[model samples]
Target chain A: MTTPRNALVPGGAADQGPASTTPSGDSRRLIYGHPSLLAERPTHYCPGCGHGIIHRLIAELLDELHLGPTTIGVASVGCSVFAYDYLGIDFVESPHGRAPAVATGVRRTRPDAFVFTYQGDGDLAAIGTAEIIHAAARGERISVVFVNNGIYGMTGGQMAPTTLLGQHTTSSPEGRDSSLAGYPIPITEMLALLPGVSYAARGSIADPSQIGKTKVMLRRAFEDQLGGGRTSIVEILSTCPVGWGMTPQESMDHVANEVVGVYPLGVLVDRRAAAAKGA
Target chain B: MTAVAERPRLMKGNEAMADAAIEAGCDAYFGYPITPQAELLERMARRMPELGRVFVQAESEVGAINMALGAAATGAKVLVSTSSPGMSLMAEAMSYMAGSELPIVLINVMRGGPGLGSIGPSQSDYFQATKGHGHGDYRVPVLAPSSISEAVALVADSFELAARYRTPVILLADGIQGQAMEPVMPTFRMPDWDTASWELTGADGREPRVVKSLHLRPEDLEVHNAHLQAKFATITEREVRWAGEQLEDAEVVVVAYGTAARVARTAIERARADGLHVGLFRPITLWPFPSKALAELAPRLRAIVVVELSAGQMVEDVRLAVERVPVFFHGRTGGMVPTPSEVVDRLRVAWALTAPTP
Candidate 1:
């Protein structure tokens, strides 16, 4: 069976550059290559950090879609603030909790240019609650790649708004108490209620298969912008090994087991088909 | 061919600046409604979309300023207007803009405020605008206009100054100016600002660009601050603006700005008609303070009486400008505006105090 047009096919995009032969001089076809849009440098992210996988997925999609030339990114104030450093596109680093507002400004000023914001759960659901809600309500024609790792990893794994009720974080050493800290925010489901949000989905980067599924949702969210739809967002449940006090492999397992239970992975909102039916 | 100037038309200060911002080639306008300056946001909401430009009445001042920051990063000329409390809300984004060196124009229609003080006219924000605008070692150009016509002209010119210096520029006025009506010639040519080298359009056929203020390394931050300081020094040398009336022969000078300056103007004239030599020294640009010009005139005057709608804020700057010049101050705080007659009484006391001993 043929794969989808926007699907991530190993390293098969047109912009993946040339294939390399083996050192033995055998003419073998290369099945995988680095994404040309991802910069070749050591990232500051800790080992087992899911930011690398998510970044690669976005870079691959941007390269495959040839969107690198016209994409403007708004990088948030968390560990992904340096997402701009890895992506080959124009970018602006926004103040803490202001990425959605900044992206709204960029998209409005340059409607022809594709815009996206990479933010963390703490940045989006806590301080920037107003900005995210309003941008989604306005149905800004931009995409959002929200990495919800359930903690503020950059600030030493503090309790974020999406932290699970019984999750143990640096700030919640005795495990989170819903009595005081409140419950984990189901932000994606809440945002889907806005008519401006044409697409909203939740995905996980727990394993290779899950990463592939996440990429599919991300592609739909991004492609929705090209169709001039309203704000499209894909919330990615990620792993933070160092922040979670787990080994790299254990972190992956925890994300696959515990995180997904809290943030159930599925397409929560898809208004494209509804729009088509209405039309 | 000589261009015919447009006839001056009566307009409120808030609406006049809104029209002047559009005329100044503002590509986007983002603002939140606040007392005294709500008309400015309303005008932009109506005019900008009609002109095929961007306008957003943002959810709050925090959102509005950030939107302005985003638009400014994309090389769009942006305008944001608000009164005192709203300006207070914008301080965080202002600090970021100053650090990132994004050029945008902000109009702060001053009201009495320590904490939502009152909507009446006041110059209490003189310190806030000129000194501690935000939490940073950065300075934004502050222009104070005493009347609606001057506010129009200053608002138009503020865009160019912001672009030229690559810094945020503030048009600091008050409720008196915002609510007052005067005939203004909203006719000015938009200046050319070449932002090709730094603006974030896209990475099309070029390396990706980052417009950011995060310099993680201390050495790198030092270099960035050095660049900002050098720009501020250049602005201080080149952009000091002020106006003087009857300074050639004056025994006392009333130093002030914004609405306070308007009151000082009338009081100065009244003092002169009474055969006492009193002049008005009005600072148009309050950040660069116009210290040199005031210092130059210090030797000719026996006393300098600084007046304001706030409790002697700009007077400290005046004292610093003319050292040991018998500086006196008169002010009314908490939404109370000083009348010309009250200022005249202060000027009389200042003149008597400066008289030769015994």
Candidate 2:
């Protein structure tokens, strides 16, 4: 449970190594440890889990947007249920699948405050489907970060609503039969169809380049909410190595190949661009 | 009392509660339409947006309650209204709110139940309201208003009590009380309480606050339950409220609440006119039960008669309070409410059975 090496420290990179005197002999130099917006504690997520990366991206965006002091995050039930413990911002924990509705409340009540919901695949597509759809349909001015790992990570690789047709989960050890388990739902595509959704995009963190792309999508989603856009959401294809019974590298390779093939990555909808083009 | 301009207006019980909530400075209202309580949501839809407050006709009762819970976490005053079935759907979130110790007001305009029984008036929810509606060793302060005026007052008071105790408060009215019209002064007064210390309003350079009910450790959960129990005990001690009419020298006391209390009052009046020693004891706070007051008044009366719309749900509480005094129950279930004449006849029979030999 050691802290991530990339955790941001107060000073810059120079503070971590031996102090280098810049002729004038100024002592203190900035270095890295953890982001200012992220808490200085080790997360309980397993090795190779994408949650840490997602958390870092969110914290980075929050810091970049200068929204740390004015942001309220709603945490959904799942592995990331303790996202509040990792983010140094105000948060409210909602019951399974209710984070979107909760975020709606916060967004409507405090329009000036940046509100967002951090949700997982099962939490967003199953029990909470109605909440997310209604929130989008209402054009609620809140940002949502949906992490799709294709399985219930915290609950030990159980079948999730977004689990692939032939995916093997604890509940579907026989390799999910379509007649029994049904097909994987494309929640991002469905949400993008709602007129109330100003932006809906899908990205992945399977590799360095994908992670960078996902971060851009995340920043854009947050910016959309800040710009008074309604119901912006970013669906990130995440990896759950422990749940998938694979090494962290193997999970990353799987996400890059199989997962990306199944769930294509890119901007599914961009209402602002569409509106400008129409005008 | 602080002086304010009084504007009397005739309004239904549901609308009165909505008006009172808005007048009390409720910042948001999230609700799903349900019979007997739809007017409350309608009123909110009409008024909340005009006042620049938040109003959402949620997709479901479950969504509405959770929305209110979310708003409450942000230190915003919130209200959610529903009927029996809707309340049942919201029970999960209500329990979560109580466990989290989030202050929010929930108005349950009860109707016949046990399962979508009917849309008519019924107090079957008395047990559900006074006892914990959701799982856990927590109790939300339940207020029963017998009249439209009391409904308005109690709806306003619900917010104050909820904020003071940091707990959910239920304004348990009935279909009749919700649908019936009565004149009331549309007075508004914001609660004199501050939530800045705990409410999750952006942390703002301070320590981040989390509004949640997740205690992983057994020992920690036990401690949390103990702390909640202490708060509930204080509320039980300080917030038990009721009304006693003509109980000084009464031979029999009629106990009731909500719409049934009004019927009992009429019954008491008719019995008194007939030269009978009958009085009415109406509980304003169903949860705290006003049991102590009833216990104090028990020894003076020969017997106690409990009148309710349900099949004697609250009679058990009455009996629990007045153990020595013989308690009798007269109830009409499945949407049938007993009239004054029927109640008076029942009271006469009860008086004969328990009154001293003469």
Worst 10 residues of 1 chain B by lDDT: B1-10
Q: Tell me the DockQ of each model, to 2 decimals.
A: 0.79, 0.79
lDDT tens per residue, model 1, A49-80: 99999999998899878898899999989999
Off by over 4 Å in 2: A1-33, A277-279, B1-8, B185-188
Per-model TM against the reference: 0.95, 0.95
What does candidate 2's lDDT look like per residue over A1-279, in tens digits?
Answer: 223234333344445565545644366444433567776677899999999999999988887799988999999999999998888889999989999889988888887899999999999999899999999999999999999999998888999988887888899898888898888899999999999999999999899899999999998898888887999999999999988889999999999989888789999898887888999
lDDT minimum window of 10 residues, candidate 2 chain A: A1-10
Error of 2 at B218 (Å): 1.7
Each candidate's fnat, listed in order, reads 0.85, 0.79
Clashes of 1: 0
lDDT of 1 by residue, B107-130 (tens): 999999889899998899989999
